[model samples]
Each structure stands twice: as structure tokens, then as C-alpha cells.
Target: MTSQQHQRAAGKRAFITGAAGGLGSATARMLARQGAKVFLTDIDGDAVATVAADINRQAGEKVAWSAPQDVRDEANWERLLAEAALAMGGLSVLVNNAGIGSLGAIGAIELNEWRRVMGVNVESVMLGCKHAMAYLRDAQPASIVNISSLAAFKVDPDYTAYNTSKAAVAALTKSVAVECARQKIDVRCNSIHPAFIRTGIVKPFFDKLGEEEATRKLVRGIPMHRMGDPDDVAYAVLYLASDESRYVTAAELVIDGGARAV
Candidate 1:
């Protein structure tokens, strides 16, 4: 099929958090190219603006805008969603992609660290789903894609806080999905679980261990024998965001390169 014919998100309005880089930026660009009007938000206003400009330039259209958003704050979530809806005319896709990773065993993890991880990774998803429901429902055939991690299922000794928070995200996605279905909201919620994608999130590990050794160790665990690119997860997000996934909800799209399967 021709590229234009493959534009699955044509005419959709998408709002994505953490849009400054990594998986979030990739998803934004892909959706824009697929003919979606996208609102990109991140705590780093300048970075997100740069991403938006880049996407618009590449697409040769005014398909994207950027905003500064702090997803952990409920008030901010409400305000941002309203602004995003206004900017995009209405919202059909909500991508709760802003999150942070923490590395510490249970005994060594500080109370503040646990709380921080939970607030960003878990509570942000809750806030996004709760606040964005009205716009999504009104828009109809809407999708909410939360970015969880394979760490949710495959626990690591050093990632106690991260794993717990992401697991909560997965559970929360299902709960939201079922509630929307029962209420006939016409809004779908799902989570993406990615393992060892070459994003900024993994840079710390590479810095701690040598890059070569870190890459080797990470790849060794994957049955596919490779680390994933940001686009790998982005394509899954695209499928979930598009109307093609209308029958799909409360699903966990794992982009782990067979790491979990193994």
C-alpha cells in the first residue's frame, strides 16, 4: 500500500506527555506523519517545543504544538488537558508517557525515593486517565496509552521502586479500561511495556557499567538478542492509538524483544 494509505491516525488529535525525547517524541512524530494533530508536553518546555518544531518541519505542516506540563499534579493535569483540547480542537488520544526510573533494593530504597517513583509512574497515569476522560469520550473511539515497563513483570533486585510503580500502572490501565467499557465511554486504555530500549532512561546503566559491557549484558537477556529502538515502542503506540485497535482495550503491548517470553 502507498504511504498515505497507511496513515492510520489521520484526522485524530493526540496529546502526549514526556514528548521531549525518547519514546514520547518518536510517537509524536509518527502520529504527525500519519496525519494526526498532536500536542506534545513535557516538564522541559524548551525541549518539547524543539521536538514540536522538528515534527512540524519534517511533516511540512502545522501538525504539532508543545506545552510545559507537570503530570504528577492533578490540577496541572486538568488544566493541561483543557488547553490541549483547545489547541487540537479536541482530543482522541492520550499518551501518559512521562515517568522516571529508580534503582535501589527494597532495604536501600529511601521512603522519598519510593514515593517519588510512585507519584510519577503510577499517580500520573491515574490523573491523566481521570482528567482526559471527558474529552476522549466526547471525541469517541479514543485511546489512552500508558508507558509502563517490562520491569513490571520481570523484577530486578535493584529496581524495587521502579518495578512496583510500573506494575501499578499496568493494573491501573486494566481498571480504567473495564470502567470505561462498563460506562460505555467509548474510550480505551492500555499500557506499553518496553524492555531495554536505547533511551535516556538506560544511559545511567551504560554510564555505571562500560557501554560495551552494559549493551552486552542487556542484549544477553533478550531472546531476540537485541535492544529495542524508541521507534519499536512507538509503532506499538501507533497501533494502539489508531482506530484499528477499536476492539482492543486493557491490553499490555510488550515491546521487549522476547525478553519476557524467554
Candidate 2:
């Protein structure tokens, strides 16, 4: 295809929440390399800018923009979209990857922590979908990849809040998929449920357990004896983000290394 044709079909503008950390940063980099103009946002201003800068340095113009955006606040989503329109032309893909990971058994869980996790993980995804649907619908062949957890389907009493929030996300994905189809919106949404990826958030937890013990403990019930990598999830994001999965929607792409299988 010619330059103009490529530009028109690229429609690769993306807004990735939680871009300052973990899987978000990994997916942002992967998307940028694949010709996307990425607008990255995080709650941490410095981290957000740092990741955007790193991507720009590595990929040049492909790295479009960056800012601090709190996913918990719907206002932030609106502002980010405005900025993304100017910086990257328009939004086509949204990676709702921002979430908190905290452990709390249901009975002893604090109300505030439970609300916070649900607000960030579940509400944030809903907000993104709510605000971006119009643009996404118009864009056609758009994608929204939400980051859920294996715990969404498989219960873990220790992390009740996180698990419940992800389960909501999974349910929301299905709801949105059906709505899009009913309305003929041309938008696609899916959830990615990952098991124990080696992101920084889990690093200290694993460190405390020691490598061998951590590995064994993580896979204690899982069939896979290894922890997942951010890239492992990133690749899954790319598959859904691209036209390769054009007909795929309302699906759960579990990147647990078959942990959830057994």
C-alpha cells in the first residue's frame, strides 16, 4: 500500500491506561512497534512520561503522546481522549489495563479497599467503554482489550476484591459485545485473564517467597509450573488489537499457561 493508503488504514491510534507500569507498558511498546501511535497515561506523572519517552526514543514518531490519567476518575478519560485526538489523530484501540492488586479475605476485607479495587478495575473499564463507544463505533473495526484475571472465573478467597472486580470486567465484556452487535456498532471487546505474570507489583511478593518456593506456590494449583511474563499477555493483546481477530469478540483470552485449564 502507498503512504496515504497506509495512513488511512492504520487507524492505529491507541490509549493505554496504566501505561507507566507492568503489562500496560509492555503492550504500549508492542503496539507502537506495530505502527500504532500510542497515547499512554498513568496515575504516576513521572512514570507515564518516562515510559512514553522511552517508547519515543526507541520507535521515533510512532510513540505519540503521554500524560497522567487516573482511571478511577471518569473526567480523566474525557481529557485523555481530547488529547489523544490531537496527538494521535483519533482513538481506535483502548487497553483498559489499569487495576490494583490487593489481598483480602471477604470477611476481613475493609470496605474502602474493596470499593477502591472495584472502582479501579471494574468501573474504570466501564467508563472507558462508555466514553469511547461513539468514537470506536464510528472508527469501525475498533478494539477494547480489558485485563481481567484467572481469579475472575476461579475463586480465591484471599483476594476477594481483585477477583470480584475482574469477574465484573468479564461480565461487562460480554454485555458490551452483545450491545455492539445489537446496535451494529462495529466495535469489538474482549477480556484477557492472566495468571501470575512477573510484573513488578508481584515481584516483592515473589521475592519474599524465594524463587523456587514462589514458582511452586504460584503453580501449586495451576497446571503450568511457570509464572507468566508481561510479553506473554502483550502478545495476546496484539492479537485482539489487530484485524487478525476481526470476527472474535466477547471472548476470554486466558494467558495463564494452561493454569486455568486444570
Candidate 3:
């Protein structure tokens, strides 16, 4: 197709949260590989800087940048987005990939723990959209990819707080998406749901149970009989961030190994 008839650019200057490692780092690497300049951020300053450096080296250029951030703080969001946009020349994609998993039943979970989960998992996404919106709008046809979880739909009794937090993320994504669409802001928002990805967050389980035992236990609930790789969810985020999914918004892209199907 000629440039005149081609789709709008992917708006590839991307800002990714919780990008020190695991799914966040994987997503950042994938986007950079596909020619998107990425800014990586996480609570762990040194780790995120290392990941960004690795990406730049891999791409044979400076395709990635990084900063430290506490996603729960709205002030951090304001400051970080500005720095990211300036570094990348402009911002077009925002990936809210920071979240936590908790294992506690209703009465067993502490209120503080519940609040912590909500603050990091749900409120952070809200703060990101609220803060990065202007830059996204400026880079029209932009995208917001929030990393939720399959637990949002397939709730587990023991993980009530985590499930609830992810559910709220899905809802918030829709709210941002619809409002943007209604107001004709041209910025799209969506969420990703992945089950049992082999990220550092789940490393404790594997450590306690032994890799063999943990893999067996985790796969029992999954139809595919295996834990997902980081790239599994990374590809999904890449799709939502790219122009390929231009018509998609306020949607949940599941990256489970058909675990939810079971």
C-alpha cells in the first residue's frame, strides 16, 4: 500500500511500568525489537536501568531508556511521564504493567494488605492514564495496555484481593477507553490477562515447592499443562500497543494457556 493509503503510525514511543524484569522487561524488549523506542520504569532503579541498557545494546543503538518510579504516587506519575516524553521526543504508548499477587481469603487478608494491592495494581493504572493522557492525545491514535490477569475473571477464593484488584483494572481500562472515544481523543485503552506466567513474582512458589513440584502444581489448573513464558504476554502487549490493533480498545486480551477455558 502507498503511504497515503497506509494505516496511521503505531505511535511507537512507549513508556512501560514495572519494567525491571519479567513481563515488563520482555514487553519492553519486544517493542524495541519491533522498532518502538521504549522508556522502562520500575520501583527497582538499578534493575530497570540494566534492562534498558541491555535493550539498547541488543538493538545496536539507544532504543530504550529507564527511570525509577513508585506507580502508586500521582506526583511520580506526573514527573515521570514528562521525563519519558521528553526523552523519547514524544510519547504514544503507555503500558501499565506494574501489579502484585496476593494469597489471602476474605477474613484472613489484612485491610492494609488489601489496600496495598489496590494501590499498586488498580490505582496505579488510573494514575497512569490520568497523567499520560495529554501526551497520548498529542500522539494521536495512541494506546494504553494495562497488565491485568486471568484471575480477574477466574477468581480464586484465596486470592481475593489480587482478583479484586485485577477486576478493578479491567473496569478502569474500559472507563478510560470509553471516555476517550466519546470525547474523540483518539487514544485507545485495553487490558491483558495472563495466567501463571513464569515471572519473578512466582519465583517464591517455585523456590518453596521445588521447580519440578511447582511446575506440576501450577500446570494442574492450566489446560496447556505448562506455565507461560514472558514472551507470551509480551507479544500480546506489543499487539495492543501497535497499529495492528488500531480498531481494538477497552478489550481484555487473555494470554493464558487456555486455563480459563477449563
Candidate 4:
């Protein structure tokens, strides 16, 4: 089949966790625009509804749906998957994008903070894969695009907890791909590792540095000389979720604007 036909056939029903945030929301909109029926979700119930409503208002009916979900809770994962299947008739893509970011040195970070970050970032991806596997198995051709970070590869100090959680996501993505292949599940799993996307997490950090210094420091680090937009990461994710990346699995697609290399 032609590439356009492949993409059109493959990208259909997609559910995005953490759809209220920068990267997730952008990804949801991108997928919807590409003719996929998207489901948006977040821990914030109100924010989830607003995002879904806004996307639907702009995109029209059958374009989007929003639900409140705690990715750490397996039951919520199951419920959301069932709801998505009911709404869209089947599941073709799952974006495990829900995550919490924490900043601190390893020795200075509280144990509770470390656990909370891991619970949200690492466990949530695990739950998404676990609960969605059955439906994905039945669907045959499906993809799970996980949201990891550049920190998963290498990292500076003062982000110990966040770094560890993303590292786990990277590892988990590989493991999921291997297991699915072995089980003949006809599913693909991969992680997208991005660096310093202009998202809500950057606002407080920028506020601390007064924007100017923060911008300068970040631009200096990234060879692209600016913070990567969430749409950059979203498009990378949409590519993996679509048929364009059908041969790709257990891969880490890094959209860091050359930050990780430099």
C-alpha cells in the first residue's frame, strides 16, 4: 500500500493519558487532525473535560473524548480502556504520557517525593501497558507510544527522582516490546525521549531564573538554541503511533533539539 494509505488505515482510535498537559494535549490534537478518534485524559478531572470539550468544539463530533484517570491505578486504566473501546469500537494506539516531574539532588530528595515520582511516571506506563494489552492483542495492529525524557539516557544533578523514573520508562518500553513479540500480540511499543519541551514544568523553573538567564542557559545547552515546542514531541509521537513507523519497536525516539548530544 502507499504510505498515505498505510497511515490513514493505521491511525484510528487513540487514547492519550495526561492529555491536559503540553505534550499530551498537543499529541491528542495532532492525532485527531490526522483522522484518528482521540481520547484525552488526565488526573485533573476538570482540566480533562475542558481539553476534550475544546478539542471537540473545534474538531467536531467523534473527534475526542475526555476522562479523569489516575494512571497509577490499574483499575482506572482498565476502565479507561473499556470506555475507549466502547466509544471508538477498538483501540489502535495508546500514549502513556501521564507523568510527574520532580527536581532535587539525590541525597537531598525526600523518599516520599522519590516514590511519588516513580509511582506516577514509571507505574503509570506499566499500568497502561498491562490493562491495554488484551484489547491491543485483539486489534492485531497497534502501537503504544510512551512519553519518556532525555533524562532517561544521561542527566545532570538536582533531578535524581525524575531521572530515575524516566530511566525506568525507557527500560519498560523495551521490555514490553520484547514480551509482545514473544507472545505474538501484533503490537509495537516504544518510548519517546524529549528534552526541555516548553511545557508547564518549565514555567516554575523559568520563574526561578527570571526567564532571561533560564532561556539563555537552556538555549546554550540545546544546539537548536531554543526550547523544543510540545508539538515537536507530539509529531514524533504521532509518527510512532501511525503506520509510518510500523517496522519500529522497542526504540527510543529522542526529540531533544540536539540537547542530549550537546
Best candidate per TM-score, number?
A: 1
Each prediction's total of clashing residue pairs, residues at least 3 apart in sequence or on different chains, is 0, 0, 0, 0
Distance from true location, Cα of 44 in model 2, Å: 0.8
Model 4 C-alpha lDDT per residue in residues 1-262, reported as the tens digit of each score: 2244444534578889998979988998778767788888898979978888877887666578888988888888888899998898889899999998898997899999988999999998998898888888777689999999999987878899999899999999999999998887779999999888889978887899988898888777788888889899988987888777888999999988887786
Candidate 1 — what's its lDDT?
Answer: 0.92
lDDT of 2 by residue, 1-262 (tens): 1253333325577889998979999998888776778888888989989999988888655555889888988888888787887787777888999998889997989999988998999999999999988768766789999999998988889988988899999999999988998887778999999998988877777779987787788777767678888999988888888877889999999888787778
> Which lDDT value does model 2 have at 111?
97
What lDDT is reached at residue 240 by model 3? 89
lDDT digits (tens) for residues 132-155 of candidate 3 = 999999998799999999998998
Cα lDDT, model 4, residue 40:
86
TM-score of each: 0.97, 0.94, 0.95, 0.94
Clashing pairs in model 2, backbone N/Cα/C closer than 3 A: none
Please write out the lDDT profile of model 1 over residues 1-262, one tens digit for every residue.
1177778898799999999999999999888888799999999999999999998888887889999988888998888889889988999999999999898998899999999989988999899999999999899989999999998899998999999999999999999999999999899999999999998987987998988989999889898888899999888988999999999999999989889987
Error of 2 at 235 (Å): 0.7
Candidate 4 local accuracy as lDDT?
0.86
Per lDDT, what order, best first? Answer: 1, 3, 4, 2
lDDT agreement with native, every candidate? 0.92, 0.85, 0.90, 0.86
